[model samples]
Target: MGSVEESPEEFTVLVTGFAPFKSEYPVNPSWEIASRLPEYLPRKDSSSSTLPRVRIVVYPEPVRVNYQTVRKLIPTLWGPNDPKINPPPGDTDAGRSFVPPAKIDLLLHIGMAGPRLHYALERVGRRDGYNLRDVDDQLLGDTAADRADPNWVWYGVPAALESDLDLDDVLQRWRAHSTDRDGVNHDLRISVDAGRYLCDFIYTSSLAHLWKQGARRRVAFLHVPAAATPERVAVGQGLVVELVRSLVETEWAARQQAGTDNKTDAKESAAAHVPADGADTVTGKWYRD
Candidate 1:
């Protein structure tokens, strides 16, 4: 590979947040963080870069996190390898690979979810004026649920990615927003199924796409607390910066390795396809009927 190619090139990272879950003002910290990812991963200059560098995308929060919807939207956002079926590239440089490299690619999922199950984070990580009561009101409004409305939101995505699967190699380590307290991992209640919620849909959808393409890097989803105050939002934003930096660095490194390996494999495969110098046609090369 050329020296230029070796340098960190513009890879794509998709950062997403959600809209109102049911009907709420949305103090969603994950959404808050997702909304500001572009700001967190800023360029050298003061202004924002107008390129498809590191993309920050936000998906609408459906009333219910339908599994089929997840199946639909993943392909919807990132689109399929076949250009004809998917929506047009939003940016001019979207499909075009970066030259000198505009940015590193990342796919992030962040959202505010209720703890309905065992793997729920005890701390909602909310500042003043924010509490279960408030978030409850926001989500449930006047509706009442006794002890049993499924509120446990599991985004053990961090855990899910690390595990090895037979279908495709996974993107294990991802950069994510940093927290002031290193209290996330320990006593960590881990759960695999985030239910059939939108989060699950998005996560599974992304994984399916990357896996199908044999994409080297993996997708990570972050579930944040519903921030109540502006201060908490600021804190959330800081964490987002940390997460973005961490995930981007990890992904960039992984992608570089993947690209290298892919090229090496291609070369080897090409050799197999090539025939003797005097031969006119061979295997795997283009053939006209």
Candidate 2:
């Protein structure tokens, strides 16, 4: 009989971007870049079977830039548990049905950064201090009000939650995979603050949801420049592709290390239970018994 080999597991990433932020920004580059992503990660070594098959699943619609809309939408994206929030309807124009992924290896939310000229991977997601109004001119509630409101959605959640992913390792891998274009080296950075806007709100919501569920905080938020030009959008897309690749690679490496450590610990634990050369066993049996 011939030997059989199992295929590599697939790593699924769910990405989302917000809609235009009011009339001033008629076109949001975040959505422009996300909507154009390829279904799968473009691997440099496509023939390598050991590498996980990275699947890129972008949310069907540009998330409305409304605080309430986002607060309702985050849970649905994570799972189909919320009866109040329903899945997006099928796209009649595209002639295809949109089904959300049951399991996501990583949830990546991309939002526009008006003043930033470089790409940033936010390390922290704040639950409070959102004073700015969303596109609908509504506040998420002041810090005091949120804390005082017993019915507040984020009442029990922490003020800030950081992603569990190793940001330092991810950044290194991202930079290595990314290339300079148009005489500009893509300046990738790690940001502690995600800005107290819809970006931070959405990020915090994702982290808190996973926390409440006792799940791994496998989430990330990327901040891209405000420029929505075709050229800029293309660059953003490239950065996102590389960023996804880095995230997957780093996580896989961490898992591999953890598995190794667990095996070593198991061996040590087993050795500790073994009887010494002359010691009697619990069953009253020994080498010379």
Candidate 3:
């Protein structure tokens, strides 16, 4: 396969951040980081030889931190794959046809972890129940004892879904250039526990949706430290953006190579079974002259 050119190619990515949940802090770090991502992403100029043209749409999901809300919104944000159903974000006027944009190439979900010093690239989201309470002192999950919420997101899903992201690649890029306000390198590590709360709930639901649609090289969840100060939040945002860009470029190149190789293999296989001159073409089988 030939090398993937560095020319400009447009790719759409959907990044989502949850609202302030049980935390006491007035501002949610997850939403803050997502709101500022567009400023850091590369912009397209007139020069056609520029880097990949990335159009990132940051959608802030303001749904309440509850099992019912998460369950309903997942399909809304990610439109249905079945042909009979209309696309999402707008399904008004049943007879009128409206096709939503293509399925996002990458879906990166960000949620704020507890007050910590480093960011975590979450590896697994468990299916166990969340029995915690939100800031309002209400139950966050819908277990048998809690209430009869019939539409739980992880109702019949697997026990756990390990992230398909290349964590090693994300970590390598983060360690190479990430730093804090004090010039101290930030600690970025692979984390197995995504917390048995809404974070895990949403992450697991995302993976399940993508899997059902057969979307590859697509989903990842990032846990950002609860940055207290504005400067700290800025630093965390920059690191996260850099890591995302690296992953996107790497995946893009890989897909290009895979496509080229598949075409080449198909051509070779076709030639190998082709009939020679003056062969028995009527039988639809290859024969020597």
TM-score of each: 0.49, 0.80, 0.70
lDDT order of candidates, best first?
2, 3, 1
Please list the residue runs of candidate 2 whose C-alpha ends up more than 4 Å from where it truly belongs after superposition.
1-8, 46-49, 81-97, 142-151, 180-184, 263-289
> Candidate 1 — which residues are off by over 4 angstroms?
1-8, 23-27, 39-69, 86-104, 115-193, 255-289
Error of 2 at 51 (Å): 2.1
Q: Give the per-residue lDDT of model 1 (tens digit) for 190-228.
A: 233344345545555566565555554345665555544
TM-score of 3: 0.70
Q: Provide the clashing-pair count of each candidate structure.
A: 23, 0, 0
- lDDT (10s digit) by residue, model 2, range 1-289: 1111223477888898888985767899899999999889887654335568888888777878778778877777787545675754322322124455777888999999885688888877887678998887888765676776877777777777767677667787778778632345677887766788999888999998998877778899999999999999998998898899888887777677779787421112222343322222335421111
Say which prediction, candidate 1 or candidate 2, comes out ahead on TM-score: 2
Which is the leading candidate under TM-score? 2
Candidate 3 clashing pairs, residues 3+ apart or interchain: none
- For model 3, the run of ten residues with the poorest summed lDDT: 90-99
Kindly list the per-residue Cα lDDT of model 3 for residues 108-135, writing each as its tens digit.
7888887887677776666666787654
Predicted structure with the largest lDDT when compared to the true one: 2
